[model samples]
Target: MPPEFVLPNYVLRVFTLFEQFSDRLALVRGERKSTYGELIADVLRIAAGLRDAGIRPGGKVLIMAANCFDAPALQLALHLHGCRALWSAPITSRREIDQFASLADADAFVYDQTTELGRELAQSLAPMTVRTMAELFTDGSPYEISATPVPDSVLQTSGTTGDPKLVHHTQAFYEQILELAGAFVANGFPLLRHYSSSPLWLASGQITSFFNLFTGGVLFLTDTWSPEEFYRVVSTERITSTYVTPPMLYELLDHPSGEDVDCSSLFMLNVGAGPATPARLRQGIARFGPVLRIVYGLSEAVVVTAQPGLTEDSAHPERLASAGTAYGDVRLEIRDDDGKVLEPGQTGEVWVQSNLTFAGYLGKPELTAETLVDGWLRTRDLGYLDADGYLFLVDRVHDMIVTTRRNWAIFCRPIEDVLASHPAVRTAAVIGVPDPVVGEAVHAFVVTRSPVPEADLQQLVTNTLNEMWTPAAIDFVPELPLTRIAKVDKVALRNLYRELHPDQTGHDDAASRAGEAR
Candidate 1:
């Protein structure tokens, strides 16, 4: 790690790159391209427009838009003016938009006119000052603003439930992020041309986009994700690096266009947001070469661990299955429920102490207190560290299903992994549903190329593990509902299960009936 060099203000650090990379192409959206000089000018103009519209420094502004040329500029303007920019997902429901708008007490709502939802939000929030991107960049007026003590930004969570929590990031956190980027660049991290398909609201996309621009790389922004389009962008633009969630990576690997796409120019393909099954990881390696970097992170703790290169030797082949070691100044520990730190190879809840962690959940002081303790953030993820210091995630602590038969705790990832290993299975999700017979029954929802009998899948898990760990019911679905960031919507599946069996009656051959409608 490089010597700690912290900036009092985050935007000041960003501005330092302006003079050097001014003429370089900074962003590319479809056919549109903008150089750093032009982008900085537009950012200032937008800031002036926002100021004229009654947005003041030290206030919060909600920005809702898809990937576009204006989105980054607006975010930069917010930071440069010392306003807390809150990024709301474009797919957010009207109710969520209203809730978040009210919860954040935003001074103004800035949106892009490209999407219907963005336009609708602009109209509905008319009572508050709502300005479209087109309206914000009307003047190239230079503006001068200084940073304040307020946080730099807020990231909204993509909770499966109707409610999403807000995580705050202070200016210190932003400084640390830029410092890490500088350190990585000094260590020969590639930054030339990058592609980002994730929505701006997601931390995964937001972080990557920031670093790419800060390092003077051209970022290819896309509103929608298609494996074919991603590959086409990579080959045509010679994209050197990109970030893909596990689900998106699966799509890229399975897409027919992937077979012939020229990916030689790609140097780094980061896999993050969720764990990638060993089978899928290997398959990705086969398709994208060994450039796959496994990243483990969450909304609260930006990035906990990342395995950049998969050079696992025979001595520690299991390192391929690990989430890699700690990142930067992050400290990792596995602790039992009683707050006892467990030794290596002991499975427990993961705790992290890091500057990368968010300040805290917005407005939920009690909840934040419960999570952040003594400068350590409770990750709530169940994992164990091996003797070689590789971290292996088992599952979310709350996601563990406890069977009534023997009061045994069953982690869903292992069962899901076994099902995914099946030849016909394309993607598999294992969720626990409430049952009268068992404390919680394991249910599997699978998307496959061809139909396979539920009994066969049950036997596969049974043979792999024991019968108790096998799914109580299996449902074949054409597709799984994804959250805004593309992770499996387990909450939706749980609700669907309840909706199907409202009475919680007997299974009544649920396997066959599960696919009937839902």
Candidate 2:
């Protein structure tokens, strides 16, 4: 057997290099910039205060804060001091905080300010140290702590269907920081100035704050995602790299600023968190140059596969729909329902094996066992591999819609892809709803630039696909609902469909009648 994986001791030593790179800019938010030395000093001070406040090795601390420079400093302090930190998005509700508090077995709850709900959560988590950042940052005697072998972080899932799952990351996850940092050194720092608007609690937020800092790169942090602000930053700051979810990407592409902004400085615009359509990929390449990099990953598995750099003129523009080949010690396989691996070109569940695979969901062994089997993470995402090893995602297993009208199965991704190709449509999402005639009917929600008759969209799909692939009814909306992770929330869309159509029957007739009225 291979030697057991161990985190390198030098992980903490990198931060000490503040003595050498003291004057270099390490973090930038708006007009304010913090040099390497300043960042390290702040982290040490906050850490010392936390240590004085009884936070110790093996203790779990819950950090609920918005996007800011202080958040990353606090996380680094917690990790260096051997404490596991759970960072929940500040937008999380009090009831959700209670769930996280229980799962983390938290020793403390940290927040910026107090609210009615925050107070309620604090009261429920009695005996847990609950303090504001100001209180925790009180001046204290200098303290030094060493990293331990315990897990360093807890990440929660997007929670589309049920309660959000808690994903734990061991020191093995942190060790990758060194590996990635080394790669940056070798590659001459491909991503020097990065920007991200993800909240401090989510995984996307952690990417820019931790990885960029680890590589001695500058990070541009933001509290919220705004297209206008994003455009101004990229054009003015010369941002070389950034990350955006599918929905956010759509917004950026559709924003008028995208046409006028000087985004030529961007070298890498990593898009992930959900599937992106081919049309959007092409449009992004046109607007942002050839810097659109498609990343496919999960909260459980940090980085599974990524399309390094895609352009319209690339070797496989058709492969633009495919999540590129795997990289960095990751192993991928497509498997069927019986846990049997499938051959290339056969669609099935995508399973991954990687050192970065998370420890497991916190406090749910059965769920963990179901997800992680034989050291392989069952991604639940349905996809296949090409002969060249490129992974093509179809749809989430649960997102597949079966049509009893023709006794055939319909995948929402392909339908949505065709819908996106339409000139009038900006973004589209497809979900299945109950129908008396057909067991399940395909329902579509779309955002369009201009009013297009419903028949035009249906005709577009009909021209591109078979009869069964057509949507039973099309509902045009200003925008689609998105989860915190920024993926189109099909669950919420389904709820909205139920609300709009109370009886949920006669979709075809409903469409015909609506057409007549129009």
Candidate 3:
């Protein structure tokens, strides 16, 4: 299937949202709450400021801030006023921040001195003209902003590679993608509200925030991940729906009284930073109830597959091991090495076709040609569909490791499940290496429990796999490197493993392995 060019009509306009839904709670930012009316007022002022600052329509405004109420509000303001908001996550390393910031041609950058690196970024953006929320409010272009054609959506690689092309997503399609999600959430509740802990530079959570804002929903603020704090929000804020990574889900499940936390008010929860184990899904279902939704899509296409109502029985059935079915308006195909579509239950590279997909790479036409062929976006992930239309993920084609014996994801489902179930292992990734005997042997990387015992943990895997699917080696790690999107950065893991062990992997900390016994 080739890409199609049918533009979706915009239903929810910014002006009407401001007028009809005024004086309602629009954003909750700790001690500072902003009503829709107040939010609109600020946005209008900011728009006026951008215009006053000589920022014409299509001029870029880079947002490098934390998860505050002002962040989403600023983005909406820019969209309303016909400017592209290049939303960057609160980057830490100066090298990373400068590297990405240098890539964009912008009128202004928005950030404050709240963080050490952030302050430095603010200084760096001074030459490029950075504007804080306070400055935007004082600008005098106060007439209501008019909508324009879609602006550019830039996609940055998660530093898995040194340089990544900016994926070109127009504002029109990006907003529509969010609108679809918000519409799905609003079918039951009076208003759709979403909360995100990760910063906006990460695409999924950024959309979750905007989905709540533009489509008749409130946006709440949480700058970073904290299980205990999230527990408070579920009860105090009466939060309805949330999107978080699997690691954060694990953190929430481990909070003191984490199991007993009252989250009955929640309508749905989206978790997609990475793959999950059956036990992790079961634990989430038990903890968050049936409202949990597992999303399995790379940043390249936003989302193509999802298993809402993430339950032990449905998405993670004992025998199925599937990532669920296609989203609305999205079609999926699993293709083999030669790009031939595979049959049901056959594994191959997964490609997707959908109205909700992105346009192309911003400046890279060759890369765009390679990715957006005809209309299909060739996702490098390997997966298969069952007879029932349920999709099962295999692994990345690039990340796939082939030893003499077999080809495995290295961090695919089986190993993720087995290790997640390990009492001492909180998170793990499996990699394959050259083996003289078995052709290829499995090496497991684990984020073990505190004071884990190396020998006991090794024995656990030996007991679990028992020669049927045993790893060539087992290594214990303090933590796995996570992508900015929050998924396990397997690329980084492979490199780090190569460095630390050089020839072989390390064992788990013997004392830390004791927690699994709990």
Candidate 4:
């Protein structure tokens, strides 16, 4: 290990807590239960192993693994060894993984050998130093702890828009998490027995794992996710907190066994990664009591805003659609195209400044510069805050559907929300498709519990907004395709639309058409 590289004080403090809670359960994966003492031992052993393998401080180590018993320990060990850990999800395509490996320019690769992808990656990235979980956990001399060079991490974006970018986070990000964890405990929040399938590659997973462990709480890591399995775990293990996307929440609400599930122990069920329809939010409140917490954040800045214990307020029933107030020390602003701050009730791009903000996009200085302007991170999400400071998201900036109808611009969230309000509609996603008449026409994909005519759904949008905002075509589907992170895959939806209508070639003329209409 490099002489200057040492573990941060915050990390040492967390490890001290682990020792204090030595015999207490720290991690659960499948039938495996690891106590805090065991976790600390594993971390130290892994650190010593890294040193023995000649992996020194500041070395960029690429990691590909599913959520497992050893993941948390491995991550902590890497940090303790003062290595820059680059995390990649096994759920993504091999091609993407290869690209990520190339982009990271890592000196070594650490993988879980149990997975086929891990084995494959290990074989493919030959000649490079590769270590498995078992090899790292082998009995070895515990690594000495000191205090100098801070460790960092590289996380993969959710890839909801397109190709995933590597998000760089310095030691400061982890320090913020420790502070947040302290605040969470001090504020009288429940000690989280967090159950999540989100992998370490994601920012959400990083925060969830670190926050739970920092507070000396049990983290239940899983690779597979289903409503039934979720209910079973919650009922059996008495899970207090968990994270899910809107789609997963809907599935839970729609599941037949949900009513009978013993979910009273659940204190906080975090719903995030995408917007949840008000109708489904109401259903969740009715079914799970006041445990639903609507969270809104990006990989660049996690936990930007959160609505805890969501309920249908009689005075502000529309707040159900809101993403809640700014969280922690975040400074939020709604800025128009001119970069001027907009007053409450004006829809604009959301920008935030906070300690939790990422360092930058690894190797993409241009993108980093574009996203992080001055001190604020432009979220690229179109939303507005009300008088009471609740944020109501409209859509992504790129997701705005340009129409020739009076040269109007339309957002998908409002249309999707309208469609979701229908009794027959279960959930809906709207995207822009190539159209000669309207430049970029609104196309909706809907999942329904019962059959409903396309005309009725179109009329719902028209009645809710106007005829101009109605979807050009509505496709009834069993379920919307989701990205690896479970966000509605709008890119896949656009491709599906193109596949269905082979005649529509390109939206090459969309910009000209839109301008001519103006």
TM-score leader = 4
Instruction: Give the alpha carbon lDDT tens digit for every residue of 228-321 in model 3.
Output: 7888887888888788887778778777787777788888888775777777777778887888877777666777778887665544365225
Pairs of residues clashing in candidate 1: none
Model 2 lDDT at residue 299: 79
lDDT of 1: 0.80
Candidate that scores best on lDDT: 4
lDDT of 2 by residue, 186-279 (tens): 7885647889887656766665567777777788888767899889888999998899988888889888757988888888899988889998
- Supply candidate 2's per-residue lDDT for 236: 91
Q: What is the lDDT of residue 271 in candidate 2?
A: 91
Separate clash counts for every candidate? 0, 0, 21, 0
Ranking by lDDT: 4, 1, 2, 3
Look at candidate 2 and tell me the lDDT of residue 361.
Answer: 88
Q: Give Cα-based local distance difference scores for all models.
A: 0.80, 0.78, 0.68, 0.87
TM-score of each: 0.91, 0.91, 0.86, 0.95
In candidate 2, list every pair of residues with a backbone clash: none
lDDT of 1 by residue, 1-518 (tens): 12232224567668777657898889898889999988888888888887888887767888888888788888888877768888887787878877777778788888888878888878877788888888987664468665454446787784545776888877767677787878877888677688887666777777788878877788888887788888888888999888888889899988987979899988888888887787788788888887888899888888899898655457876677789999888899999999899999999999998888888888889989999998999998999998867899988887877677887888888888889989899889887776657756888989997878999999999998999999988888888887767888777777676676667634443522332222
Q: Where in model 1 is the C-alpha error above 4 Å?
A: 1-8, 138-141, 145-151, 311-313, 451-453, 499-518
